[model samples]
Target: MKKLVISLALCATNSLFAQQNWLGNTSPTYEELIAHLQQLDRSHKEVKLYNMGPSDYGQPIYLCVVNGHRDSSETFEKARQSTTILINNAIHPGEPDGINACLIWLDQWIRAGKPLKSHDGGDLPVIAFIPAYNVGGMYNRSSTSRANQNGPEEYGFRGSTKNLDLNRDFTKMDAVNTYTFVKIFQALDPDIFIDNHVSNGADYPYTLTYISSMKERLAPSMQALTYAHCIPTIKDYCQIGNFELFPYVELKGETPEEGIVAFNDLPRYAMGYASLFHSLSFTVETHMLKPFPERVKATLQFMNATIAYAIGNAERIEIARKEAIQWSQAQTYFRFNYQMNEQVKDSIRFKGYKAVYPIHPITGLAQLEYDRKQPYEKYIPYYHFYISQDSIAVPKYYIVGGQETKVIASLKANGVEFQTLDSFETKTVTCQFVKSYKAPTRPYEGHFKLSEIEIASSEQAILLKPGDILIPAQQERAYFIHAVLQAKAEDSYFTWNFFDSYLQQKEYFSAYVFKAQIEDLLSKNPELKKSYEEKKALDIKFAQSEWDQLFYIYQRSPYFEQTFMRLPVYELND
Candidate 1:
């Protein structure tokens, strides 16, 4: 037993040395993270490692599930029966404080015999965390990624191995990491989720702040507990620990004092994704301007406070989540496309440094600046409410063709309850035909996203083959189903270029052949000719370009592929 302890200590020592050399300031590398988890597994009976799917860089993601038992089944059974808190670390590898902080927290937790218990003497909330979410990003290390961050000496880059921001890829499921993450997320179904990050936009006096899941979007059952109990309790805990807390200091026009608004956490972001599950989630944003050590310490404090709160209210949280699941299953209309409600006023006593402008030597222009020496406090009107501007009625079911392998793979990764059609069958389906869509002028996160979406739908009989997928809308993940399936939803697969094939015209007619075809096409149909003439009259470009006229005529004729504008997924009527 003593030899085992000695061996584990030596392994930990070697791993710590490797981490310090690789990261330069205590942030763990991918190798060190694996090593640390191994050591924890050996040293404590409470630790269990769950392997997720491979990342884009071909490394497996791991979730550490900690409880009072050595058996994995027992631990997971307890998690299912009680409450669970999931902490995700090092998503943006450049912001690695959470990685180191969680490591330290674990060491302390083990030393203290893992005495986490619920207030009523029931089982404590099970703690689960991804040691390092973006393995590729962590290994792709550098010294210059985050220019404003202090004293990391060297840190990992923000982009994953594919050079995509994983944060923005959550709802899109572009990267393999995001795909694996969805699997892990649905499997655990944590009551509380904390995604650790570092803030780069605005400099403030507070070392630790967080962006909560939009209260309006959170289910009513969980909303009151989050706003009234959990947040306030954690805020108090931070204050008592000598680290002040505040809402994430979002700014506009260069400074926070100019009136801060709530973070528009579209489904692409972690918090927004968690909100879909009605899980109380937060994005812990440590100040980037602070020293790395200070930032890590503050993050540890914040995490500790969060765990304490979760433990205290485990039963209540569990009940809230159950209620939320039932509420979602019964929901027919789900809201999307949220906008901030500036009219509904609320305030936060912001602790910040005074802002000033100074001339830049290179540009000879005034630059915005903040003076940390001149600290000030004021009641700033904070608009944190998000009004859901648009909504979509829930569909009965979604059918995907066999050709959409990528979409099928994403559905599988997200644990979307689906079944493959056993044989070819024809059925009446409500289908959307794309009219027109516009991609961004420039690439974002390695793909040109279509933002301007327009579609037309009709009920028609469609064939479903053996490999096609059938996804029902009635499930625990109903809201997520709505978000991913809705074409115009901000982060839908359509917006992420999943259905790019539909945007292209696979069949076309030659100009010479179409000239004769157009005369016949227009002469037979007076209404079509009248519409073409009106279009030509209304737009000079249409009138001047003879080629455009012929192409339009051909498009209206049988030359265009009928399936060209059709989305892969079809809706089945109940």
Candidate 2:
């Protein structure tokens, strides 16, 4: 046992050493990444640097779009034509492995002065690399930088005013300069997105390479495809982690025991926004905890593989990418030029996660969790989620609560004005396309089309046919229920009485809670249990209850219904 720990430590150190050597192993400040990008641009005509937006720290977050062809607005919406690979590094500033890989990839691709043609047999894939995600954090100090970039890393993190863990802050849009990089994304949509970050450390050799949970149309295997078509170049050279289970090869939201089933962490999310609304996105995590050199090697391996992934899956890849950008450009909820965010949740660590964040006057934060355990050698495949471009819309941005003060700051920063409407002023609200969903009472796949929907609430919050509804205003302590029950992946888009930004958690937490409660209640009541035993008959009521609840909230709030549901409106008997 002791020997194992020592071995892990040694591996980590060696990896770090290699990582440092790769990109010159120097810790770059926001300025350095920019300078490196500029140098790449100056040397290569194929690479063009476009500024996305300023980050929180008032630094210019650059969007490096590399290709021989210029992207016009008309071609921007056409996903069939352009196949883009979006790469982001340093979202967690302390993790520098990805940035080095990014820098190296740029140098190798554009070929500076002699750049004659594209990489692929003449038609190279277009790549968008945002080397630094959290310029604010990147500018800060690193206990492990080995070399400093942003003024010695000492002034980078005070944790006050900037109390944000950037990853967590995604749900709350910020008007700060850091958002600049993201702005272009909304404008020019890319095909495949890879948001990069370093893992905590190398304690786990498996703490590397992540594939985001994406729409079914995207991959035969997110991680596997990365391995098969994209990431193989660096697999041996760089330590990689694949999303697998202990024994099962199938992808599922729950285990035999029933718990929160989480997918990839940062890359999962960064790309999720794209996937959920329309784009195919993936997050890549290189284990920084490994020796820096190892991390760099792994990151470079990922970069190479990612380019190949886009190339290998060129046709479908274009469909997914164009769909994302065009969808974003014309997306109902995402179109407002306003930023949208969702809370990430976990079940074991943070059980019973809910989107209970209220609107206006009472702001509570929507929490998120990333980096759950990677199943051992026995790996289970993931059941992909549905991402539709149905287009939900919101007219005016409403602050769900005071807790959303940061949201307000961000909203205001983005130039969005929010007015707290009295019952009369509640006339305007956000509208979005919520794909329709219907799940069986017995365990089954939920089915529904992506439809346009709006949300606001006075009596009840806006509702969707919730897949795994977690009810009861209170709990006996989150995630404590043993033998928790759960709904399948198809049972997503559940009921909620409140709103925040959005939190794309496992959806397992709420499912487990609701499944557990329902299963328990049916077991306890003979009549009710017997009635529910005929799940097909009872499912109508279960689903209706959900729609009805949401209907009440929508009717109460200024937001109106955008789609149809079997909601209970009145009782003839009453």
Candidate 3:
């Protein structure tokens, strides 16, 4: 009888393990999530799980590979030839719908034993999944952070371990998560990239919506297919799956009906980063007002639609992407710092519930109130067109000073093709001298990014020392190179405070010592004295302040470092 009881207990334990306890119709803790992913990999030959890399807080990030043709190692190269899709979940860990949704999709797909078909008719398109991108943030679980979001009993925080928003750190790459992400991205070289998220603005009827990489900014070969085919097909698929989908709603003053503007995604954003590589990218946003399970279902439907569309249109997308790459190689210049072209506009049929301003009982101030009973649809102006107001000529190579280690590391991280100079030599090179640039008074994405910059270019003889990097602009990473090196770019390293040390004077002269130097400077040079006296006579402040006068004289002197204000990148011609 005791032996019989032992056998029964063992059977019961096995049955309990088989149950879907990991996915409890809601968010799962990081440990439980990993356990489920491992289980899927073990059970299915087509699915594999990999630890991407260590997160900021010593947690290992994981990625799931689902290929239809064969085992993971056996078919990666074959999978690459076909359309590859990369889906990232839980970037903001508080938005945990994607985590649960991805788990459900993998479970069902694996159970069905169906593999994705390829456009090449040989191997299948691979699904590269980053289960939870912000691992540190995902493990830092909390229930109160997402106060407005409806039903996930508990979830993670918005910020990473170091309190950095990983979304904004794509370009700056301050977090370890981003660095590891680069490894995964380069390895997959995906044809399509999707980042899952939850919306936090005005409530709308649509359960699922997406922000595509701006159409105007997309490669010429891809512009037509994106709007005319991919978008519409995905919309139809999602609708068929019983999920209402729409273009991402950008609200103005808590009212979406006021009209929406196309979100300008800079390199700092995931979509923008993917756009630089000519990849079709999107950001999936589910309605935060809905229940967690509903949001998860909506996200699942969106992912399914995305995969279906990618698989069906694989050949066309591949052709367009290759054409785009070919066109990019022939390009000689890159534009930056785009602004909305108000003169040009398109219309999107928008659907939303009515919202009104009402006095809040707590704060006694006007607040937005949405009435679900009243619903309407209308064509609204979408300022989707953008014109690049500034442009930089693509140089054959960019020479970076050996001392700029930070710049070198970033260039390498972005996959910029570069080589080190063998020997120290003085060469006449064209370079930009930073005249003036404005930094925002308030911090944006943990940075007071530079903007509205002015530069003066001149041909000067500079030393190209050994170990200095020579970055070539004739490769795939040309767009990224131009964007980051150009001072005018809003998302450049210069704007992100990477080269801030150069902005300040490392060496200075005392006012007492400068007075004597100024007197000698004025006496020796007639042109200098004339210019200085005229300036002093014209401006009362210059004449009255002895410190200002001395500083002005000091600036005109050779003692001031000429290279101090100049950008490190030196342009080389073909």
Candidate 4:
């Protein structure tokens, strides 16, 4: 180990010294970045670059591992067993601070003799990074994409080749990049996960801001480890590096003076997806107003601090993750639909510039801007509490219909364990029916994303056909399963349009033809007859319209389609 470290140090100093290309107001192109990493992989055995999978742009997404075992399989195995930190860069390719920061970290580590131990003599964690996640965006580079960003000569666009925001593709898995990302993420199974980006909000004095996984969404062990241990430790380390760490500036109202709220890290985002499986997830946001070099430096400092934290607390992290997995398996209910509790507020000492609205000379409109000359430091209301509006009783197993191939593929990609039924069978299970939902008028991330979802559940005897998948809730990925399968969860597959076909009424009855059947349907069922009479008596519109009366009775009749609004996923409680 000593010899290898010394050799790496010599290689770093002599042949592969730290390059200045990433140190200024410039970022590397996709080809240049890959070629550099490939060179490093060839030069040092500790550095390993793997072509995980292809992106939407037809280019392969790469995972670069530092301090790995010599062989590919063994390196991944070591990462899974030991403490690991996985940094994902350039998800939004325009925010390339992480890419430069990671490069600088590699250079500095190699030059520092590649120490294998922390300051307290604990083993250093495995460090892995996805050099550039959005390959298409990285290739389509320009300077004008980020109009408000400071001093990057050129950068990639925010959208992928498919014109989808890759950040929002995590739960939906619409882009090939998401699949590759899942492959990389599951392979590493890192204890700490970071997605790097630049901020797009109010001007804050702090250059570095981080968004941790929402506390309500995390398992108890993970929640404590993240908020009580990891964050505080990283903040101290950042302070030591001559920088301050703050929460992401997600404004409560319009500006910082009104206060900031904790970011709701829904499963659609990269960090939130990682948190589902108990990774200590964070999104690093460098102030976009800061110079490119300054942002890069701050990002690098954060990386160092996080790595230092992982090194010092490797055992604790591993234990917390293990406990989290167990906690997930033991969960009786899965809570979601988290809304920020505006009424509950804590105070944080914030340093920010005064918000000023001035008339724009070009447009003759009042523009909101931060006054650099009027910086202030004071306590501000920080609304960090989030309350889960709903929760579902977790089932023993979830049986997904055979036709839901896309959802099955997504679950498989995330390493969810399940058994495929070989033959048909019948079992009583709890199924969710879509009561109501609102879809966006316009497309979001290539989907008419669903919202305001209300669901109703009932016990039903469902026939399990051949090729149907039964996923046990007593597995390591239970949290992930619940996050996607629960129809009303904010980022569930249903919300992402995975089960849109089921939402549509596949079959409809002609009002004239069904009118004859409605009389017999109500006559045979006394309860239905009473309800129909009550509806006609109470509602003037129902009494007046023949089609409405006939259709309403027809929908409740036995001839109506059973699977019209029923979800393909069924839960087995017993």
Query: Against the unseen true structure, what C-alpha lDDT does each candidate score?
Result: 0.82, 0.43, 0.80, 0.90
**Model 4 misplacement above 4 A:** 1-18, 71-75
Task: Tell me the TM-score of model 3.
Answer: 0.91
Kindly list the per-residue Cα lDDT of model 1 for residues 61-80, writing each as its tens digit: 98888883533532356665
lDDT over C-alpha atoms for residue 12 of model 1: 62
Model 4: per-residue lDDT, tens digit, 199-318? 997887888899999998899999999999999999998889889999999988999889889999988899999999899999999989899999999999998888888888888988
Candidate 1 or 2, higher lDDT?
A: 1
Identify the candidate with maximal TM-score.
Answer: 4
Clashes of 4: 0
Q: Rank by lDDT, highest first.
A: 4, 1, 3, 2
List runs of model 3 lying over 4 Å from the truth: 1-25, 68-76, 118-123, 440-442, 510-530
Q: In terms of lDDT, which candidate is stronger, 2 or 3?
A: 3
Considering only N, C-alpha and C atoms within 3 Å, which residue pairs clash in candidate 3? Answer: none
Best by lDDT: 4
Tens-place lDDT per residue, model 2, 1-574, is 9997986676446444533434454556667567656755664566677666666666667777777345643344422356666776666666666677776665554334334333645345777677776777666664544332211222133221254555533323432533554455545556666776654321233435565543232323333343344434334323334421111111233232222233432211455444432445556665444455555665677666556556656775555434433433332232111111123322222112222223344445543222234323222223323333332222222223333343334333332323442332122222232233332344211112121233332233333222212222112111101001010011112221012123222222233334434544545556654544465355676555654433333332323332332121100110
Off by over 4 Å in 1: 1-25, 68-75, 116-122, 360-363, 511-553, 558-560
Model 4 scores worst on lDDT over the 10 consecutive residues at 10-19
Model 3, residue 358: displacement in angstroms? 3.2
How many backbone clashes are present in model 3? 0
